[model samples]
Target: MVVLATKVYVSGDAYERSRDALRSLVDNEIGDLDVEYTIGVREDNFAIVTIEGDDEVVARNVLREAYGEVTPNFEDGETYLGTLESWGEDGIVLDAGRDIEIPADNLGLGQGTPIQIVERFGLVQHMPLRFVYREGDGNAGASELADEERDRLYDWTRGTGRVNVNSATRGEVRATVNRAGHANDIVTVERLGLLEQSIVCKEGTDPPGLLAAIGEYLPAEIRCVIP
Candidate 1:
Protein backbone atom coordinates (compact mmCIF):
# COMPACT_ATOMS: atom_id res chain seq x y z
CA MET A 1 0.00 0.00 0.00
CA VAL A 2 1.24 3.48 -0.91
CA VAL A 3 -0.27 6.60 0.60
CA LEU A 4 -0.27 9.42 -1.93
CA ALA A 5 1.04 12.79 -0.79
CA THR A 6 -1.74 14.92 -2.30
CA LYS A 7 -5.26 15.33 -0.92
CA VAL A 8 -8.71 15.11 -2.47
CA TYR A 9 -10.72 17.71 -0.56
CA VAL A 10 -13.93 17.98 -2.58
CA SER A 11 -17.40 16.99 -1.39
CA GLY A 12 -20.86 15.96 -2.72
CA ASP A 13 -21.07 15.37 -6.49
CA ALA A 14 -17.70 16.99 -6.97
CA TYR A 15 -16.25 14.52 -4.50
CA GLU A 16 -17.49 11.52 -6.42
CA ARG A 17 -16.29 12.95 -9.73
CA SER A 18 -12.86 13.72 -8.32
CA ARG A 19 -12.52 10.21 -6.90
CA ASP A 20 -13.44 8.65 -10.22
CA ALA A 21 -10.98 10.88 -12.00
CA LEU A 22 -8.23 9.94 -9.56
CA ARG A 23 -8.98 6.25 -9.94
CA SER A 24 -8.80 6.54 -13.69
CA LEU A 25 -5.52 8.38 -13.39
CA VAL A 26 -4.02 5.70 -11.19
CA ASP A 27 -5.29 2.95 -13.46
CA ASN A 28 -3.84 4.66 -16.49
CA GLU A 29 -0.51 4.91 -14.75
CA ILE A 30 -0.30 1.23 -13.76
CA GLY A 31 -2.72 -0.62 -16.04
CA ASP A 32 -0.15 -2.12 -18.38
CA LEU A 33 1.75 -3.73 -15.53
CA ASP A 34 0.74 -7.06 -14.00
CA VAL A 35 -0.95 -5.41 -11.05
CA GLU A 36 -4.45 -5.19 -9.63
CA TYR A 37 -5.06 -2.07 -7.62
CA THR A 38 -7.74 -0.52 -5.44
CA ILE A 39 -7.84 3.18 -4.59
CA GLY A 40 -9.53 4.53 -1.47
CA VAL A 41 -9.90 8.14 -0.35
CA ARG A 42 -9.35 8.49 3.36
CA GLU A 43 -11.26 10.79 5.70
CA ASP A 44 -8.10 12.84 6.07
CA ASN A 45 -8.28 13.61 2.31
CA PHE A 46 -5.33 11.42 1.21
CA ALA A 47 -5.64 8.61 -1.29
CA ILE A 48 -4.57 5.09 -0.30
CA VAL A 49 -3.59 2.76 -3.10
CA THR A 50 -3.24 -0.99 -2.58
CA ILE A 51 -1.65 -3.16 -5.17
CA GLU A 52 -1.57 -6.94 -5.49
CA GLY A 53 -0.20 -8.66 -8.52
CA ASP A 54 2.76 -10.44 -10.04
CA ASP A 55 4.71 -7.23 -10.49
CA GLU A 56 3.75 -5.51 -7.29
CA VAL A 57 7.16 -3.93 -6.68
CA VAL A 58 7.28 -2.47 -10.18
CA ALA A 59 3.73 -1.22 -9.89
CA ARG A 60 4.53 0.36 -6.55
CA ASN A 61 7.51 2.17 -7.99
CA VAL A 62 5.42 3.38 -10.92
CA LEU A 63 2.78 4.80 -8.60
CA ARG A 64 5.38 6.44 -6.40
CA GLU A 65 7.04 8.04 -9.41
CA ALA A 66 3.70 9.40 -10.58
CA TYR A 67 2.15 10.36 -7.20
CA GLY A 68 4.64 10.97 -4.40
CA GLU A 69 4.34 8.80 -1.32
CA VAL A 70 3.18 10.28 1.97
CA THR A 71 5.49 9.58 4.89
CA PRO A 72 4.96 10.02 8.61
CA ASN A 73 8.41 11.56 9.16
CA PHE A 74 10.55 14.12 7.39
CA GLU A 75 14.23 13.60 6.61
CA ASP A 76 16.92 16.23 6.25
CA GLY A 77 17.64 17.40 2.69
CA GLU A 78 14.86 15.20 1.29
CA THR A 79 12.16 16.85 -0.80
CA TYR A 80 8.53 16.27 0.17
CA LEU A 81 5.16 17.36 -1.11
CA GLY A 82 3.13 19.60 1.21
CA THR A 83 -0.11 21.52 1.05
CA LEU A 84 -0.24 25.28 1.56
CA GLU A 85 -2.21 25.53 4.79
CA SER A 86 -1.70 29.13 5.89
CA TRP A 87 0.55 32.16 5.50
CA GLY A 88 1.52 34.95 7.89
CA GLU A 89 4.10 37.68 8.41
CA ASP A 90 6.48 35.03 9.73
CA GLY A 91 6.27 32.59 6.84
CA ILE A 92 4.16 30.04 4.99
CA VAL A 93 2.87 26.97 6.79
CA LEU A 94 2.43 23.63 5.04
CA ASP A 95 0.50 20.63 6.31
CA ALA A 96 2.51 17.53 5.50
CA GLY A 97 0.83 15.66 8.37
CA ARG A 98 2.69 18.07 10.64
CA ASP A 99 3.12 21.81 10.25
CA ILE A 100 6.17 22.55 8.11
CA GLU A 101 6.90 26.26 8.15
CA ILE A 102 8.93 27.92 5.40
CA PRO A 103 10.23 31.26 6.54
CA ALA A 104 9.89 34.30 4.28
CA ASP A 105 13.65 34.55 3.91
CA ASN A 106 13.83 30.89 2.89
CA LEU A 107 11.24 31.36 0.14
CA GLY A 108 14.10 32.28 -2.27
CA LEU A 109 11.62 33.24 -4.96
CA GLY A 110 12.53 36.95 -4.77
CA GLN A 111 11.44 39.94 -2.58
CA GLY A 112 8.29 40.29 -0.45
CA THR A 113 6.68 38.51 2.50
CA PRO A 114 5.21 35.04 2.58
CA ILE A 115 1.82 36.30 1.47
CA GLN A 116 3.38 38.25 -1.34
CA ILE A 117 5.30 35.18 -2.49
CA VAL A 118 2.10 33.15 -2.47
CA GLU A 119 0.35 35.76 -4.59
CA ARG A 120 3.32 36.07 -6.95
CA PHE A 121 3.31 32.33 -7.53
CA GLY A 122 -0.47 32.28 -7.96
CA LEU A 123 -0.64 29.63 -5.25
CA VAL A 124 -4.15 28.72 -4.11
CA GLN A 125 -4.97 27.56 -0.61
CA HIS A 126 -4.26 23.84 -0.07
CA MET A 127 -2.22 23.67 -3.23
CA PRO A 128 0.67 21.22 -3.00
CA LEU A 129 4.30 22.43 -3.06
CA ARG A 130 7.59 20.60 -2.93
CA PHE A 131 10.17 21.54 -0.31
CA VAL A 132 13.27 20.35 1.48
CA TYR A 133 13.32 20.15 5.30
CA ARG A 134 16.50 20.99 7.19
CA GLU A 135 17.13 19.76 10.71
CA GLY A 136 18.55 22.23 13.23
CA ASP A 137 18.14 23.53 16.79
CA GLY A 138 15.51 26.28 16.94
CA ASN A 139 14.73 26.83 13.24
CA ALA A 140 15.91 23.34 12.43
CA GLY A 141 13.14 21.25 10.84
CA ALA A 142 12.25 24.38 8.93
CA SER A 143 11.37 23.79 5.28
CA GLU A 144 12.41 25.64 2.16
CA LEU A 145 10.93 25.51 -1.32
CA ALA A 146 13.16 23.48 -3.62
CA ASP A 147 15.26 25.78 -5.79
CA GLU A 148 14.26 23.94 -8.99
CA GLU A 149 10.59 24.08 -8.00
CA ARG A 150 10.80 27.78 -7.17
CA ASP A 151 12.51 28.45 -10.47
CA ARG A 152 9.80 26.55 -12.38
CA LEU A 153 7.05 28.65 -10.76
CA TYR A 154 9.02 31.86 -11.35
CA ASP A 155 9.35 30.95 -15.04
CA TRP A 156 5.58 30.60 -15.38
CA THR A 157 5.05 34.21 -14.29
CA ARG A 158 7.50 35.38 -16.94
CA GLY A 159 5.28 34.08 -19.73
CA THR A 160 2.11 35.98 -20.65
CA GLY A 161 -1.32 34.43 -21.33
CA ARG A 162 -1.77 32.14 -18.35
CA VAL A 163 -5.03 32.06 -16.42
CA ASN A 164 -4.86 30.73 -12.87
CA VAL A 165 -8.18 29.55 -11.45
CA ASN A 166 -8.72 28.34 -7.93
CA SER A 167 -11.43 26.43 -6.00
CA ALA A 168 -12.44 24.29 -8.98
CA THR A 169 -11.40 20.83 -10.12
CA ARG A 170 -9.47 20.36 -13.36
CA GLY A 171 -12.41 18.47 -14.89
CA GLU A 172 -14.88 21.19 -13.93
CA VAL A 173 -12.59 23.96 -15.19
CA ARG A 174 -12.02 22.17 -18.50
CA ALA A 175 -15.75 21.63 -18.94
CA THR A 176 -16.42 25.27 -18.17
CA VAL A 177 -13.92 26.46 -20.76
CA ASN A 178 -15.45 24.13 -23.33
CA ARG A 179 -19.00 25.17 -22.47
CA ALA A 180 -17.99 28.81 -22.67
CA GLY A 181 -16.98 28.14 -26.32
CA HIS A 182 -13.36 29.16 -25.80
CA ALA A 183 -11.73 25.75 -25.80
CA ASN A 184 -9.49 26.78 -28.64
CA ASP A 185 -8.15 29.63 -26.57
CA ILE A 186 -6.49 27.22 -24.12
CA VAL A 187 -3.61 24.88 -24.84
CA THR A 188 -3.89 22.88 -21.62
CA VAL A 189 -5.31 23.05 -18.10
CA GLU A 190 -2.51 22.35 -15.60
CA ARG A 191 -3.52 20.99 -12.23
CA LEU A 192 -2.01 23.00 -9.40
CA GLY A 193 -4.04 21.21 -6.75
CA LEU A 194 -7.00 18.89 -6.57
CA LEU A 195 -9.16 21.99 -7.08
CA GLU A 196 -6.84 24.66 -8.47
CA GLN A 197 -5.99 24.67 -12.17
CA SER A 198 -3.94 26.90 -14.44
CA ILE A 199 -5.19 27.37 -17.96
CA VAL A 200 -2.34 27.86 -20.41
CA CYS A 201 -3.56 30.03 -23.23
CA LYS A 202 -2.76 29.00 -26.79
CA GLU A 203 -0.29 31.01 -28.84
CA GLY A 204 -1.51 34.52 -29.67
CA THR A 205 -4.46 33.99 -27.25
CA ASP A 206 -4.81 36.54 -24.48
CA PRO A 207 -5.16 35.13 -20.98
CA PRO A 208 -7.41 37.93 -19.76
CA GLY A 209 -9.68 37.54 -22.77
CA LEU A 210 -9.99 33.83 -22.19
CA LEU A 211 -10.74 34.41 -18.53
CA ALA A 212 -13.41 36.97 -19.39
CA ALA A 213 -15.01 34.63 -21.90
CA ILE A 214 -15.28 31.75 -19.44
CA GLY A 215 -15.66 33.69 -16.21
CA GLU A 216 -19.45 33.36 -16.22
CA TYR A 217 -19.40 29.60 -16.64
CA LEU A 218 -17.12 28.92 -13.67
CA PRO A 219 -18.41 29.56 -10.17
CA ALA A 220 -14.92 29.72 -8.63
CA GLU A 221 -12.64 32.75 -8.38
CA ILE A 222 -10.15 33.17 -11.24
CA ARG A 223 -6.99 35.28 -11.33
CA CYS A 224 -4.79 36.24 -14.25
CA VAL A 225 -0.96 36.44 -14.19
CA ILE A 226 0.18 38.91 -16.82
CA PRO A 227 3.75 38.83 -18.08
Candidate 2:
Protein backbone atom coordinates (compact mmCIF):
# COMPACT_ATOMS: atom_id res chain seq x y z
CA MET A 1 0.00 0.00 0.00
CA VAL A 2 1.29 3.43 -0.94
CA VAL A 3 -0.16 6.75 0.17
CA LEU A 4 -0.22 9.24 -2.70
CA ALA A 5 1.08 12.74 -2.07
CA THR A 6 -1.95 14.37 -3.75
CA LYS A 7 -5.36 14.59 -2.05
CA VAL A 8 -9.11 14.08 -2.67
CA TYR A 9 -10.67 16.61 -0.34
CA VAL A 10 -13.92 17.26 -2.18
CA SER A 11 -17.10 15.87 -0.59
CA GLY A 12 -20.43 14.35 -1.71
CA ASP A 13 -21.05 13.74 -5.43
CA ALA A 14 -17.89 15.64 -6.22
CA TYR A 15 -16.00 13.16 -4.09
CA GLU A 16 -17.44 10.24 -6.02
CA ARG A 17 -16.57 11.88 -9.35
CA SER A 18 -13.05 12.63 -8.14
CA ARG A 19 -12.59 8.99 -7.07
CA ASP A 20 -13.74 7.73 -10.43
CA ALA A 21 -11.42 10.21 -12.10
CA LEU A 22 -8.56 8.95 -9.94
CA ARG A 23 -9.36 5.35 -10.87
CA SER A 24 -9.19 6.28 -14.54
CA LEU A 25 -5.93 8.16 -13.96
CA VAL A 26 -4.36 5.21 -12.17
CA ASP A 27 -5.54 2.79 -14.83
CA ASN A 28 -4.03 4.94 -17.53
CA GLU A 29 -0.69 5.01 -15.71
CA ILE A 30 -0.31 1.29 -14.89
CA GLY A 31 -2.99 -0.66 -16.73
CA ASP A 32 -0.51 -2.22 -19.17
CA LEU A 33 1.40 -3.70 -16.24
CA ASP A 34 0.48 -7.12 -14.78
CA VAL A 35 -0.87 -5.68 -11.53
CA GLU A 36 -4.20 -5.39 -9.76
CA TYR A 37 -4.75 -2.32 -7.60
CA THR A 38 -7.41 -1.00 -5.24
CA ILE A 39 -7.79 2.72 -4.62
CA GLY A 40 -8.77 4.16 -1.24
CA VAL A 41 -8.59 7.43 0.63
CA ARG A 42 -7.52 8.11 4.21
CA GLU A 43 -9.47 10.18 6.73
CA ASP A 44 -6.94 12.90 6.02
CA ASN A 45 -7.89 12.81 2.32
CA PHE A 46 -4.60 11.39 1.01
CA ALA A 47 -5.14 8.59 -1.50
CA ILE A 48 -3.88 5.05 -0.92
CA VAL A 49 -3.30 2.37 -3.56
CA THR A 50 -2.76 -1.31 -2.86
CA ILE A 51 -1.11 -3.21 -5.66
CA GLU A 52 -0.24 -6.86 -6.18
CA GLY A 53 0.81 -9.07 -9.07
CA ASP A 54 3.83 -9.94 -11.20
CA ASP A 55 4.48 -6.34 -12.22
CA GLU A 56 3.48 -4.67 -8.91
CA VAL A 57 7.02 -3.41 -8.27
CA VAL A 58 7.22 -1.62 -11.59
CA ALA A 59 3.68 -0.31 -11.25
CA ARG A 60 4.45 1.10 -7.80
CA ASN A 61 7.51 2.94 -9.09
CA VAL A 62 5.49 4.36 -11.94
CA LEU A 63 2.80 5.66 -9.57
CA ARG A 64 5.43 7.14 -7.28
CA GLU A 65 7.05 8.98 -10.14
CA ALA A 66 3.70 10.24 -11.38
CA TYR A 67 2.30 11.42 -8.01
CA GLY A 68 5.02 11.20 -5.36
CA GLU A 69 4.43 9.25 -2.10
CA VAL A 70 3.56 10.05 1.49
CA THR A 71 5.44 7.79 3.89
CA PRO A 72 5.78 7.61 7.64
CA ASN A 73 9.44 8.50 7.35
CA PHE A 74 10.83 11.11 4.97
CA GLU A 75 14.45 10.71 3.94
CA ASP A 76 16.54 13.79 4.69
CA GLY A 77 17.39 15.88 1.63
CA GLU A 78 14.87 13.91 -0.41
CA THR A 79 12.21 15.84 -2.30
CA TYR A 80 8.54 14.99 -1.76
CA LEU A 81 5.17 16.47 -2.63
CA GLY A 82 2.56 17.89 -0.25
CA THR A 83 -0.75 19.75 -0.27
CA LEU A 84 -0.81 23.40 0.73
CA GLU A 85 -2.46 23.57 4.17
CA SER A 86 -2.06 27.19 5.26
CA TRP A 87 0.10 30.28 5.02
CA GLY A 88 0.85 32.93 7.60
CA GLU A 89 3.24 35.68 8.65
CA ASP A 90 5.79 33.05 9.63
CA GLY A 91 5.60 30.58 6.78
CA ILE A 92 3.41 27.98 5.15
CA VAL A 93 2.10 24.61 6.36
CA LEU A 94 1.78 21.52 4.17
CA ASP A 95 0.07 18.20 4.73
CA ALA A 96 2.21 15.27 3.48
CA GLY A 97 0.81 12.40 5.59
CA ARG A 98 2.09 14.82 8.21
CA ASP A 99 2.04 18.60 8.58
CA ILE A 100 5.38 20.04 7.46
CA GLU A 101 6.04 23.75 7.97
CA ILE A 102 8.27 25.47 5.43
CA PRO A 103 9.76 28.72 6.63
CA ALA A 104 9.49 32.08 4.85
CA ASP A 105 13.18 32.33 3.97
CA ASN A 106 13.18 28.83 2.55
CA LEU A 107 10.24 29.45 0.19
CA GLY A 108 12.78 30.54 -2.48
CA LEU A 109 10.15 32.20 -4.67
CA GLY A 110 11.37 35.75 -3.97
CA GLN A 111 11.50 38.36 -1.17
CA GLY A 112 8.12 38.48 0.53
CA THR A 113 6.18 37.25 3.51
CA PRO A 114 4.78 33.75 3.16
CA ILE A 115 1.24 35.02 2.61
CA GLN A 116 2.46 37.51 0.06
CA ILE A 117 4.30 34.79 -1.78
CA VAL A 118 1.22 32.62 -1.68
CA GLU A 119 -0.80 35.44 -3.27
CA ARG A 120 1.82 36.16 -5.92
CA PHE A 121 2.08 32.51 -6.91
CA GLY A 122 -1.70 31.95 -6.64
CA LEU A 123 -1.24 28.83 -4.52
CA VAL A 124 -4.66 27.55 -3.65
CA GLN A 125 -5.24 25.40 -0.59
CA HIS A 126 -4.93 21.67 -1.23
CA MET A 127 -2.78 22.17 -4.36
CA PRO A 128 0.16 19.78 -4.41
CA LEU A 129 3.68 21.23 -4.26
CA ARG A 130 7.11 19.62 -4.38
CA PHE A 131 9.62 20.27 -1.60
CA VAL A 132 12.94 19.00 -0.25
CA TYR A 133 12.74 17.55 3.26
CA ARG A 134 15.08 18.51 6.10
CA GLU A 135 14.84 16.42 9.26
CA GLY A 136 15.19 18.32 12.50
CA ASP A 137 17.30 17.20 15.48
CA GLY A 138 14.99 14.78 17.36
CA ASN A 139 12.01 16.62 15.95
CA ALA A 140 9.69 16.47 12.97
CA GLY A 141 11.24 17.27 9.61
CA ALA A 142 11.34 20.72 7.97
CA SER A 143 11.00 21.40 4.24
CA GLU A 144 11.79 23.94 1.55
CA LEU A 145 9.97 24.33 -1.73
CA ALA A 146 11.90 22.41 -4.40
CA ASP A 147 13.70 24.21 -7.23
CA GLU A 148 11.54 22.55 -9.87
CA GLU A 149 8.41 23.62 -8.04
CA ARG A 150 9.73 27.15 -7.81
CA ASP A 151 10.50 27.13 -11.49
CA ARG A 152 7.02 25.96 -12.34
CA LEU A 153 5.41 28.72 -10.25
CA TYR A 154 7.77 31.26 -11.79
CA ASP A 155 6.79 30.12 -15.26
CA TRP A 156 3.15 30.82 -14.45
CA THR A 157 4.07 34.50 -14.11
CA ARG A 158 5.94 34.54 -17.40
CA GLY A 159 2.73 33.51 -19.14
CA THR A 160 -0.38 35.68 -19.65
CA GLY A 161 -1.36 35.07 -15.98
CA ARG A 162 -3.70 32.45 -14.53
CA VAL A 163 -6.39 31.72 -11.99
CA ASN A 164 -5.52 28.78 -9.76
CA VAL A 165 -8.26 26.92 -7.98
CA ASN A 166 -8.72 24.03 -5.54
CA SER A 167 -11.53 21.58 -4.62
CA ALA A 168 -12.74 21.45 -8.24
CA THR A 169 -11.76 19.22 -11.11
CA ARG A 170 -10.45 20.64 -14.39
CA GLY A 171 -13.73 19.84 -16.11
CA GLU A 172 -15.67 21.63 -13.42
CA VAL A 173 -13.51 24.73 -13.71
CA ARG A 174 -13.84 24.74 -17.46
CA ALA A 175 -17.59 24.37 -17.14
CA THR A 176 -17.70 27.22 -14.69
CA VAL A 177 -15.75 29.44 -17.03
CA ASN A 178 -18.08 28.56 -19.86
CA ARG A 179 -21.17 29.12 -17.72
CA ALA A 180 -19.78 32.51 -16.75
CA GLY A 181 -19.54 33.41 -20.43
CA HIS A 182 -15.73 33.67 -20.38
CA ALA A 183 -14.82 30.53 -22.29
CA ASN A 184 -12.99 32.59 -24.88
CA ASP A 185 -11.14 34.47 -22.16
CA ILE A 186 -9.09 31.41 -21.27
CA VAL A 187 -6.52 29.73 -23.45
CA THR A 188 -6.74 26.46 -21.55
CA VAL A 189 -7.46 24.86 -18.22
CA GLU A 190 -4.34 23.09 -16.95
CA ARG A 191 -4.71 20.27 -14.46
CA LEU A 192 -2.50 20.92 -11.48
CA GLY A 193 -3.69 17.91 -9.52
CA LEU A 194 -6.79 15.72 -9.39
CA LEU A 195 -8.90 18.55 -7.97
CA GLU A 196 -6.64 21.53 -8.56
CA GLN A 197 -6.64 23.45 -11.84
CA SER A 198 -5.08 26.48 -13.46
CA ILE A 199 -7.05 28.56 -15.92
CA VAL A 200 -4.55 30.05 -18.33
CA CYS A 201 -5.82 33.33 -19.74
CA LYS A 202 -5.75 34.52 -23.36
CA GLU A 203 -3.36 37.28 -24.34
CA GLY A 204 -5.83 40.10 -23.62
CA THR A 205 -7.81 38.47 -20.82
CA ASP A 206 -7.24 39.86 -17.33
CA PRO A 207 -6.65 37.01 -14.90
CA PRO A 208 -8.14 38.85 -11.93
CA GLY A 209 -11.16 39.85 -13.97
CA LEU A 210 -11.60 36.32 -15.18
CA LEU A 211 -11.22 35.10 -11.62
CA ALA A 212 -13.94 37.50 -10.46
CA ALA A 213 -16.28 36.50 -13.29
CA ILE A 214 -15.96 32.83 -12.44
CA GLY A 215 -15.43 32.99 -8.68
CA GLU A 216 -19.16 33.00 -7.95
CA TYR A 217 -19.56 29.75 -9.82
CA LEU A 218 -16.98 27.81 -7.77
CA PRO A 219 -17.45 27.12 -4.09
CA ALA A 220 -13.71 26.74 -3.58
CA GLU A 221 -10.56 28.71 -2.99
CA ILE A 222 -9.51 30.70 -6.08
CA ARG A 223 -6.37 32.79 -6.49
CA CYS A 224 -5.32 34.87 -9.49
CA VAL A 225 -1.73 35.09 -10.73
CA ILE A 226 -1.37 38.48 -12.35
CA PRO A 227 1.45 38.90 -14.83
Question: Would you estimate the TM-scores of all the predictions?
Answer: 0.90, 0.94
Per-residue error (Å), model 2, residue 156: 1.1
The lDDT for every candidate, in the order shown, is: 0.80, 0.90
Clashing pairs in 1: 136-140
Give a tens-digit lDDT track for model 1, residues 28-71.
Answer: 88989998889887777778899999999998888777767778
User: For model 2, what is the error of residue 46's alpha carbon versus the real structure, in angstroms, after optimal superposition?
Assistant: 0.2
Which tens-of-lDDT digit does each residue in 29-134 have in candidate 2?
Answer: 9999999999999999999999999999999999999888988888889988999999999889999888888988778899989989999999999899998899
Worst 10 residues of 1 by lDDT: 134-143
Q: What's the CA error at residue 167 for candidate 2, in Å?
A: 0.6
In candidate 1, clashing pairs total: 1
The prediction achieving the highest TM-score against the true structure is 2
Q: What is the alpha-carbon lDDT of model 2 when measured against the actual structure?
A: 0.90
Q: In candidate 2, how many Å is residue 13 off?
A: 1.1
Segments of candidate 1 deviating more than 4 angstroms: 137-141
